[model samples]
Target: MSLLRRWFDPIRSRWFFQKPTRQEVLPTEQGLSIYLRLDDVYSYLAVQQLPQLEEILTDDLKPLKVVISDTAAEPPNGMTKTEWHTYCLNDAKILATQHRFSYDEEKPEQPTQEALKQAETILKNTPLTGQNFLYLLEDVFHMLWQQQYGKLRTLFVMASQHQKPQETPERVFDHTPVLASYFEFGGRKYHAVDDLLRLTRRLKQQKLLTDNPIFLINHIEWREHLMSDAEELAEIQAMHPELDLYIALEDPISWLLLAYIKEELADYYNIQMNLYPLSYRSRDHFDWSLATRLSKRAEVEFTPFCRPTADSILEMAHLFYSVPDDEQVDAMYEILKAVWTKGKDFSFKSHFQQMQQLLSIEQLTDVNVAELLARNDALCDQKHQPDFPVLELRINGKHYVFNSLYRVWMIESIFSNVLEQLYKSENDAENNEFEISKE
Candidate 1:
């Protein structure tokens, strides 16, 4: 439901239904102190909304010293604030020629401990306002670039503006190190796979995976969704930044940092956030039509295999929410192997067909299809998962253990397995029916 309609509902409770407040909008720091703008949610999740403040706080970026600045600010009086920063960069350059500076004017020098201490003090005390930060960053970049341009062989950039929406793919050839593409959802058309793939290749040329990272800044539209095309641009960058580039998703880039941490510390700090699974709104939960399209477009495998049999669907559905009290979820593996082994003939497409037939049979078995449909609709309204304390049946008949979180994942797995079996069964039934009709 829309936010507006929720407020007007007769059962409205102000506190529970309140829209996001400013205080609520800001995320808290959990393991890391990663402060991000209220925007910047879409880089990770596929959902259309931002996570709760609690979830955001727990995100991987929580520990970084995040610096959020307003992109636009006018200068003092008649002049703009940005003008001053530009002027300062110019002044610093002019001063460097006349003043006694260390190292080459073009190349930066490695400082002594005392010099390092002084530089640290300068960085800490400098007022990094709208205009000044970039200039300061440029000076540092120039120094670093001169020192290791050949060795590093990478480009670093931070783009703050959104690219125009109507710009064609052909026009995107004039790409920079970090090009911000504007994208807004709700009404904007999705880019074609060819366009996206081409853009990804182009970004790869810019060394997205190199030591230098291209940062594309954009506004938050639908919480986790991008307000502009920056999401598209970022996606391209992520495909292959350097030879092995890393795309930092959220403001804090927890996964990127975790890749460096020792395994002991990493395991201790880990928590899975993408835990919940979307349930079926209708009897078509096993449908793979859309999944097939998406997987094909991405050039990735997305097959759901299963063995045929009415019993297997029920077993799979039961297992979907099933969890054992033991500490391991090994039982699910046994079940998967057993089902596929039994239905050796089932392929991905055939399995989906079986699922549709199974659901159809259930519907037909009911005396009142309309009444059952209504009840099904009601059930759909409530978000129910396999109740906690789920059970798992292993091949050895030895039960493994699971917690609520593990159970949630187990249910999804079972659903996939069950779909595979049911779909195959349905395809077999259809082939038989077709043969009979021809005879």
Candidate 2:
């Protein structure tokens, strides 16, 4: 780890998360406050869930407030506004499908500026605090996502802006919207479904959740269900899905992901995972603090005993390549655990010897560590994403590169989609054959 990271990681992990935003530390009194804006797909998805959220919160946390931001955030770097908008729509569709939420599977029309103005006019006119806000907002989201512009236009015209509503809670949500939509409770923000579940779990700990067993829907169905028999497993294997998992020795998330993929995914599927060790800048998506939070959530042990040096990383890289492809998974796990958890610094000769003995590895005479790393780096360079734990998924004759460890779930999703396509194509062939026979 670099000197900056060494100092910064701990502080970020410790202080940054603990400090609440300037918003009201008033989960008890302020209830649940949601912030959203038009033309944001996640805002639409989040609005769908609020009616359920409003039902479950205690009387103290009743009345969900919707704070409409004037504008959506700029697209992430490297993407045009159109590209970002398209990506968000597609991404939101996936989330909608995953959560079984109400959504149009086809590309929905963007809300016209006039429609946005009308919706905003209705929302701002509606009481800024109460369940009524969520109901009206839900109607707006449904109309927007379902492409019911005519109904939205009628509602906009008929809806009463004449009812003046109190806006005392506006003082609490002063910050601009960064992501699509999020809930502010007790001065902290909880994002769409995943983080919303986290918030409810926190409430459950306080014995504040209703008797309703409000649990997050598990979106990723493990292959154990999809592959019912040897025949199905064979068919899935025929799809030729390949995962190129890139990890960094210094990154804690890389260690977490190696174990996750090996245990959660690799064991069940015939997919080949080509491991590479090329790391770049950390994306805002998953900082060390978030990784550590997920660590506790996953019940995985994550403790850094020593920061790796450049010399140590090179030595470890050579050691990594020395292991055969089949045994590399186990070897990688041991190497990471040793340096990260067991304090076996590979830079020291004694520690290096211990690890070599552990993996039963001999420094191969033909292995060129520098050449191998360069090759991997060059192959990975094709993916324009600059982040650690980069997953290059090649499946069903298509290539998809995801830049975060948070998205390991996509592997299973792709497999499911591919399986559906295979089944559909096979049925079509069988029908064609029968039609030819009949003729």
Candidate 3:
């Protein structure tokens, strides 16, 4: 059997191989609860798109808005305060461009408690409809982004006298201050443009799609941009770059990503690749269920994952980096496939012997292994990355970090300028060869 079939066949049979079933949504239960933070730019963007979304989804979208404080929001994926701010702001701008919305370049000041109270009053007074609520939402964002305190205060005061409490569903998590700009539907949370697309897909799957299926704005079609082999080879030959990947051996996503890079990206890019293996900050924070689901959905999914301990993960990293430079890639590939696909227990003496034999290594030592792991941990800290399987692409001096497999297309977008230059170089080379052959 082919290696691909060997790895994925078990997972396909055990996890997601069953006949497809359309999810059922009761008429009364069809509601999209949107949680918004008053000061969040992404929230404003989502609000802007809601009118069109409502038009498409029709009355089935039972819209509910939950206002929260951005200041009290938790940093997702363990990012530091500053790092989270930078990423959100930058990502918001990119999303705005994709959605054709004007994003303010300057970071807006945080709204005061008084401002939020006034805003709540307005929300309480205004009827929640596609047109009514969206207009009010736009005005609110304008007031916040433009720092129109006097106008905002007056509006709030005017609405306060007529304020009536608006009821909505209870919040999901017990986190004191909630994360901003997420939509919850059928017990799943989705945030931002990418996730909104996923949410739309779910609605369709549930047979809840309205007669008019509106195209989701700001949604980048990533799969359509996958380069052909000739194109990839030409680009690689024209412009060689480097890739630095931070991954955790215990992470199923990381293993899947490694397989992808090896099969689709390795030979196509004449680039220096650096793999930094890391341990999770907190194993409890890892979502095992989600990981399993994602692994099952992967094109080259592996099953029977042998969960590795922190020590075992570190040992694997040490062993991987200890191998000869020419043999490192093959060694890492074999190790991961064995562990995840074949369920090889890395902690066992027999498995260690098997790996050593596969790598043709006479002996292995753990010299400086602790120090190496510490260095990897320190790198994660420096980058303000709290998650595993992050791909950081450094071109010249700038680094772009991508946290999910879905964002691989963003990497291609980032390399567009270089790709263009490479394309021109390729054209010039072909022209030169043509002239020489004609002579």
Task: Give the Cα lDDT of each candidate.
Answer: 0.27, 0.68, 0.64
| Residue-level lDDT for 137 in candidate 1 | 31
Clashes of each: 38, 0, 0
After superposing candidate 2 on the true structure, give the runs of residues whose Cα lies further than 4 Å from its correct spot: 1-30, 71-83, 108-112, 127-129, 158-175, 186-188, 213-218, 221-231, 238-240, 280-300, 305-318, 321-330, 344-388, 403-405, 435-439
Q: Order the candidate numbers by lDDT, best to worst.
A: 2, 3, 1
Superposition TM-score, candidate 2 onto the true structure: 0.77
lDDT of 3 by residue, 150-265 (tens): 99888887776666565544222122364557776766677745577767777776666674445445343523334556765575445556667777777777787777666556
Error of 1 at 144 (Å): 40
lDDT of 1 by residue, 287-321 (tens): 23323333333233323222123333333333322
- Candidate achieving higher TM-score, 1 or 2: 2
User: Residue 247 deviation, candidate 3, in Å?
Assistant: 0.9
Clashing pairs in 3: none
lDDT of 2 by residue, 1-439 (tens): 4556555554554464454422222356666677777777788888777777777777776555657676667665355677667767766676777667787887666778877777765665555455666677788888876878898877666555455434656423334745568877776777765577667766666666676645447544322344457776677777667788877676777887777677656656767778887533233243445566666555566654355666677778877888888877788888988865555556668778898889998664357776777777776655544346778888778877766554567777777777888889999999999999999
Superposed by TM-score, candidate 1 places the C-alpha of residue 246 at a distance from the truth, in angstroms, of 29
Residue 428, candidate 3: how far off, in angstroms?
Answer: 20
**Which candidate leads in lDDT?**
2
